[model samples]
Target: ETVNGSEDIDTSMDMLQRQKYHHKRAFEYISQALKIDETQNSEQKEIAINLYQEGINELSRGINIDVWQGTGEKWIKAQRLHDKMQTNLAMAKDRLNFLATGKLSSRRPANLTIMNK
Candidate 1:
């Protein structure tokens, strides 16, 4: 029983590491997408944002699984970070949409206004 429990923990840890690896890659993609959008086109940026959001969702699920497996603190920290990242990503996407459509209704910092000269 003890050996089986240890093996389960090891498997869980490996899965967690894999999730973290994917999360890091997603973050890199997001950064590259932003840079590309600034100088090239917006399509890649949108694609990257979508990929990042999907990655975030995957990470959230991994964290939930970890919590269910008895890893509480790590799961909680992962969840908190995931929430923050989601909020930031949403704000960024909203800003991008506003720039594309001249519609700030869906933008965050809800009171954001432009002062024109």
Candidate 2:
């Protein structure tokens, strides 16, 4: 079997690559939101955190669909995306807590503070 001058397998592989690219973009967006949250002042941090968490939750739902209903390759990609999103969510929570209180407990390297010009 062939598709568009490539084997059928290659066509599917191409689609999978596109899907993975979209998934990676979603992860990047979530990470960017977390970075934005980290730079927010105490008064605005709560709202920023809430928004970031919402985006994470939406991404998780999309991942669930991809893992359970998508093709095998997509399922594997979704699983990896989910893991990355989980890490981003944890980082967001840590930043939220730090903003709520004066204590910063994250042992990892500090994230660069995002500044709005």
Candidate 3:
């Protein structure tokens, strides 16, 4: 029983460690994406959007596996980060679309007139 317990603990730790690695990588991708000017910087913007998509994919892969079985808090945090990455992915795609079309995907006005208060 003791040997089996040790193996279980080792397996659980390994899973948690992998999840942590995934979380860190996803955060990095989002950070890079945020630094890019997806609206104007055409060259870098494309790279940034691609990074965002990669981040979303990383999170998706991590979330697919069960993790943090012993610690509910860690599981919840990972889940939240995964959800946030999904939003980031959608926004990046929108930015990419806007960059290609010179207009927002939402179809907002292209020119904005400054109004005096």
Best by lDDT: 3
The digit string of per-residue lDDT tens for model 1 on 1-117 reads 234477776775775576566557656655654666567566565665565455445444433433334455655665565565556556555645654565766334434454221
Question: Which 10 consecutive positions of candidate 3 have the poorest summed lDDT?
Answer: 108-117
> Candidates' TM-scores?
0.51, 0.46, 0.58
State the lDDT at 98 in candidate 3: 66
Residue runs of model 3 more than 4 Å from their true location after superposition = 1-4, 38-40, 68-117
Candidate 2 structure quality by residue, lDDT tens digits, 1-117: 232354655755655555466556656665666666657655666666666666556555544443433355545665676677667656656765665576867464453333222
**lDDT for every model?**
0.55, 0.57, 0.65
Error of 2 at 89 (Å): 1.4
Candidates in descending TM-score order: 3, 1, 2
Compute the lDDT for candidate 2: 0.57
- The regions of model 1 sitting more than 4 angstroms off are 1-4, 37-69, 99-102, 110-117
Candidate 3 Cα deviation (angstroms), residue 87: 5.5
Please list the Cα RMSD from the true structure of every candidate, rounded to 1 decimal place. 6.2, 9.4, 6.8
For candidate 1, give the lDDT of residue 46.
60
